[model samples]
Target: MNETKEMRLAAINNLIKFISERGRRFFYRERNRMTGEPQTAYLKLKNNRIYFVDAYTSKEVYAYSGYPHDGFSHGGTLWALVCDFSIFVRTGKSSNGKHGYGGLYSGDWGHGDEIQEEIINYAKEIGYLE
Candidate 1:
């Protein structure tokens, strides 16, 4: 879905704040059998939508919609990072194809350096990250 520069940046800023307040407490990663290193950021939900942001990716990532559900259910938690910042669940099952886009390759999309840049730019534009 398309979003205005303002809205995108606002969301980004909000995410940053949320992360700072929660600190690393909101993160979860799995160990890589081969490298023996932990995977990147873990997807988790707080409010109603799934917030997508990776500390590893220098590039800015977008906020993808999560499972379609309300905040009342799921203990007011409805976020899940299925794969990077691309595939996420906000309220219900947020399949890539289900949202109208076909980026359903079952892969992580928050590996790009632009993820950070995008987030910074949007945050600044919306006065959130500043």
Candidate 2:
């Protein structure tokens, strides 16, 4: 599906609402020391599966269902289900060099970081963070 930026944003907002309705709170904000941009990490767990999306980029969405060594604190298990541009791919190699898990891509959704930050901040204002 060729998703426009607005469509993708709507989908992401819907996902956040769905996850929130499931009684799972998952949102974290961090600042890059150099760029000073706020990066938000959206994570939710349901039925032993972890769902993750980078709020600032939204380039790669991850879903992992396996034994998480530390309650998924590491962001992934030995394998990862990654979706990029609606294409699902499974990978075992670590993208951040952290014990052979997760994957990384090199692009964004073209919505810019400000929009992403706004979404996250709005979520927080609505009490979506924990």
Candidate 3:
């Protein structure tokens, strides 16, 4: 792989590690209410930032800086850490309907499709995703 690809993979691996170490797995009741089935999500914390991931779909991954949270569950902190790392995977522009990119307004926004696929594939390879 080229330097860029290697760097991307490294970043992805780091994020996965982060989440695996400091993430939480929760049945998102709000989403589950609508979907009918349990919608599993992973949440992580870092300083004042919060990272969220749809564990099943691996499609919803983003970070929220300055997020207000009283506390977090003790379970699955590792997974939460990995999800928190998702922020680096896709930095988005400040738009009305775009994914929140660390609460930033301007950046490369990363490669959404490629990164998403890589995340999904990597998660499966490591048994994070079934």
Q: What is the TM-score of each candidate against the true structure?
A: 0.25, 0.24, 0.26
Query: How many steric clashes between backbone atoms does each model show?
Result: 21, 1, 19
Using lDDT as the measure, name the better of candidate 1 and candidate 3: 3
The model with the greatest lDDT is 3
lDDT by residue (tens digit), candidate 3, 14-129: 43443333323123332443356654455443343445545444343334433322232223332333333444333311122133333111223233555545545564443334
lDDT of 1 at 38: 49
Per-residue lDDT for 7-106 in model 2, tens only? Answer: 4434444545433333222333344333457544444433433355554343233454434332233233212322221222122111231333322221
Model 3 C-alpha RMSD vs. true structure (Å) is 14.3
Worst 10 residues of 2 by lDDT: 85-94
> Against the true structure, whose TM-score is highest?
3
lDDT of 1 by residue, 1-130 (tens): 3554334434544544543333232332344334556433433444544434443331223345445232111111223322323232222222433443333232233334445445345434443323
| Regions of model 2 farther than 4 Å from truth | 1-3, 28-74, 77-130
Candidate 3, residue 54: CA error in Å?
6.0
Model 3 misplaced stretches (Cα beyond 4 Å): 1-31, 42-62, 68-83, 90-130
